[model samples]
Target: MSRTTLTLGPLLYNWPAADWRDFYARIADEAPVDTVCIGEVVCSKRQPFYADVIPETIERLERAGKTVILSTLALPTLDRELKYCGSLAREASQMIEVNDISTIPALAKRPHAIGPLINVYNEAAAAFLIAGGAARIALPPELPLKSISAIVAAARNAVIEVWAFGRIPLAISARCYHARLHGRTKDSCQFVCEQDLDGLDVETLDGERFLAVNGVQTLSYSYCNLIFEARQLESLGVSALRLSPHTCDMVAVSQIFRDVLDGIREPSHAMRAMRTICSDAAFSNGFVHGTNGALYVLE
Candidate 1:
């Protein structure tokens, strides 16, 4: 069997333009990831700040022998948002990842890929998309191993990717929680979400750490760590593993995962190295085991 491909998912945060550019520049030069997905998937408001920077970033990544993919918005509601996605699908040279069902029409049966934000839960759904010309489908992060294995078994024509790392994106809302937290409406509030690099952590009234808030996106506080499950996922015929971007030392993070996937380092040793790389990250693998998403199951 071939080695599983490692893909760096799009940056979901709103960092300064320089920071964003520098981050990708470094990834292009140093990260071991085989694929890199860029473009704003979180908020349209954040796009303008780094809009002009994307082309250059893509050029740099492609020059580095990486397959680059442009991702559409996960939630495109407004007419302008819809129009922008339509245009991107019709014009972009690189392969695009469709994050919303609305963008499907724009795809025009073109050879495109599917993002995790789309609700593809079964083999039939995966087959329907592959027949529609989808080259690959990044399965939703919340799926269990059984569902994933079944989908992989049936969709032999398309590459099936698993969400292997980063905080699981739980839900997205029409309302901007970041603006509301700062006493401003979605329209009036400044881009306050940019302040939180990863996301704003939420806790219960009793002080238990809960979820995270990023503008309209609610995510898990615990970062999803699948280092222990990489080999198993590959065994189940998973074609690729996606590692979402975080503000932490991601190049080191990718290298560690690459070593484990390549069988150069044991998962336990890599887990220890990961602690030093992302000390604040609370590792979780329960979702793969069909348990609480926040819990880490070693078996």
Candidate 2:
């Protein structure tokens, strides 16, 4: 059986610089992933805090036999943000994963990656991206398995990736929800998003867990768990599983997925272990099954 490649997606939360460095360092030395995406994928304002540690993290991951890729911001609005994406596209030594389409022209002729944020819902979109020099494409998490299969079949040559774990990113906004909740505006806010490493929970009127709020990104309350579908995903032509980073033990999470893919552990056992690691979180496989994004569907 062929081994499915595992990838560490760029961290989406505003974690401390030291924590970010340590997390990547541990992943580089311990995780069994094939590729590690590093850089700021959320707000560019948070980039300066951890920009210095990225180079060292890249060096460590590369030295450990991991392909390191730089990720562009998911929503590039400001002039500086556009410039940052341009810089990433210009980096010759590393492959860049563009979360925003505005970074495409800058990466023209250069081999680049299309992040999950890009709306690649059809074969035409996938073909366009592949023709535009996309070497790899991480499909959006909300896509159903049939859509994924079709996209995978259409994107024959490029490496196809799926969101295997972590909170599903739902939307990106111009205003900061975290700041608004804390009674601050997008500009005047003092980085209140840093308070929630796993994202601030957004509950419903009845106090039920509903969504999560980052600076501007809105995420699903339940974590998307695909441990049980690893084999089926590989059978459908998915080459890699992109694991979004959270505050949990990501190395263990990667290991569990690796074990399941290798046929060394049952999905049930792995799911149980994962629940233990992520005690407060609920699991969801609904989007993959063509249902609601928050419900867990057992097949």
Candidate 3:
């Protein structure tokens, strides 16, 4: 097996500030991921809660020999949010990941990374970003394997990445579903989304777990597990596998990915170990196979 770098994406959920800090600290000290994207990409309201710890987190990860990329918000609706994104582009000397297209202007001429939220569906889209100083792209999770391969082939100068773990981010809304579910308005959310370390589960009327609500974002119930597809991904020119942060033991998760990538563990054995680690969460790679996004198909 050829070497493929693992990237730990930013913490999406609104975890307690101390818990968030401690999680990154542990990752820095023990996780095998080569790159770590820090900062918030979801709700700006939650950023203030953990904003203070980001600098220390960056320092710690850098000290641990991890490449750190600062992430911007996925939706830049408010003036403050846009300003914040601009500030990150101007002030952050390290590579920045643009989650929203609105932040692209701010990052022009600067080598930046494109987050999965940008929807690089075709070669043209990929080329546009690459021309705009994008050094890497984490492809959208919903894209089929064929499309991913096409984009990867088109991106000669940029490193191609895929979402290899964590829940699939289905959609993001202006309304706060977390607050709506709790009988409150978006303005009065009171940060209740903190209760679920993972996003709050949204079940169908038939009691089937279907989606999760994280403030303004909607996510898939099934965690995206690509342990079996690592070889295929690497062969397709994807040099990086992105593992989004979840409530699970990420250090163990990183170890599993590293072992699989290094040929130290068989894909089957790694999948079994992941099952044990994420017992409550179902796993899926159907989107990559061009079928239902929640179904798992093995080749």
Candidate 4:
């Protein structure tokens, strides 16, 4: 099987600015990822807290021989948010990942990659992005195997990546659930989301854990695990596996995927190792298999 490169996706939670800085500093020195995406893709309010550290982090990662990509906000609503997206589009240090259509016009002529948050479910969307100067694309997590194969076929010459790890980001809303749960509006959110590093878990009325709320983004309850399907992904011509960051042992996680891709370890062994590091959340690969998003099938 051909080796699939690993990519460390941007941090999704609103961690302390110092914690955020330390995370990337460690990743630059230790993680085995080919690319590291840096920027705020969630709430725009969180950007100001760690905005100054972005340049240094990117420089540090670049110096360490890691490719850096700037990710745009997944859902831009305010005028300030649009301006921030434009600024990111005009950036010259690294390539930008378009997470929302609002960013497309600003990034029209520039070379950029489409992030998973943007809906690229069919051939038409994939072709449109490629025509608009998309050099690479990370397909949405909800896309099934058939759709993935079709999109890959549609963009045969362009680089294709998938959200192969972490909790699948399901949706983005204008209202902050964290604020809503606290009886506060988005403007008066009071930075409540920073309390949960992994996000606040939501459960169904039956007491079944269902999803998680992080500011305005909603994530799947189960961590998307594809350790057992690494070879299958490579067979489908997938070029990269995007591993979203969490407050866990990411260096070891990256090494596990690296060893599996390098043929030094088996999928079963990698699965066991992952369980040891992952927080007590269920694992699922059902969305990729064309079923409910939370089911996992072991081959």
- Best prediction by TM-score: 1
Residue runs of model 2 more than 4 Å from their true location after superposition: none
lDDT of 3 at 140: 92
Candidate 2: residue 87 lDDT (0-100) = 77
In order of appearance, the predictions have TM-scores of 0.99, 0.98, 0.98, 0.97
Q: Evaluate candidate 4 by giving its C-alpha RMSD to the native, one decimal.
A: 1.2
- The Cα error of candidate 1 at residue 122, in Å, is 0.7
Select the stronger candidate by lDDT from 2 and 4. 2
lDDT comparison, 1 vs 3, better candidate = 1
- Candidate 3 C-alpha lDDT tens digits along 1-299: 33679999888899999999999999999999999999989899998888899889999999999999998899989999999999889888889999998888887668999999988999999998898799999999999999999998889789889999999899998999999999998899999999988999889999998999899999999999999999889888888999999989999999999999888999999999999999898999999999999999978
Clashing pairs in 2: none
Candidate 2 global CA lDDT score? 0.92
Estimate the lDDT of model 4.
Answer: 0.89
lDDT of model number 3: 0.92
lDDT of 4 by residue, 108-176 (tens): 567788999988889898888898899889999988889888888778867889888898899899899
For candidate 1, the lDDT comes to 0.93
Error of 2 at 101 (Å): 0.7
CA RMSD of all predictions: 0.7, 0.9, 1.0, 1.2
Candidate 4 residue pairs in backbone clash: none
Tell me the whole-model lDDT of each prediction, alpha carbons only. 0.93, 0.92, 0.92, 0.89
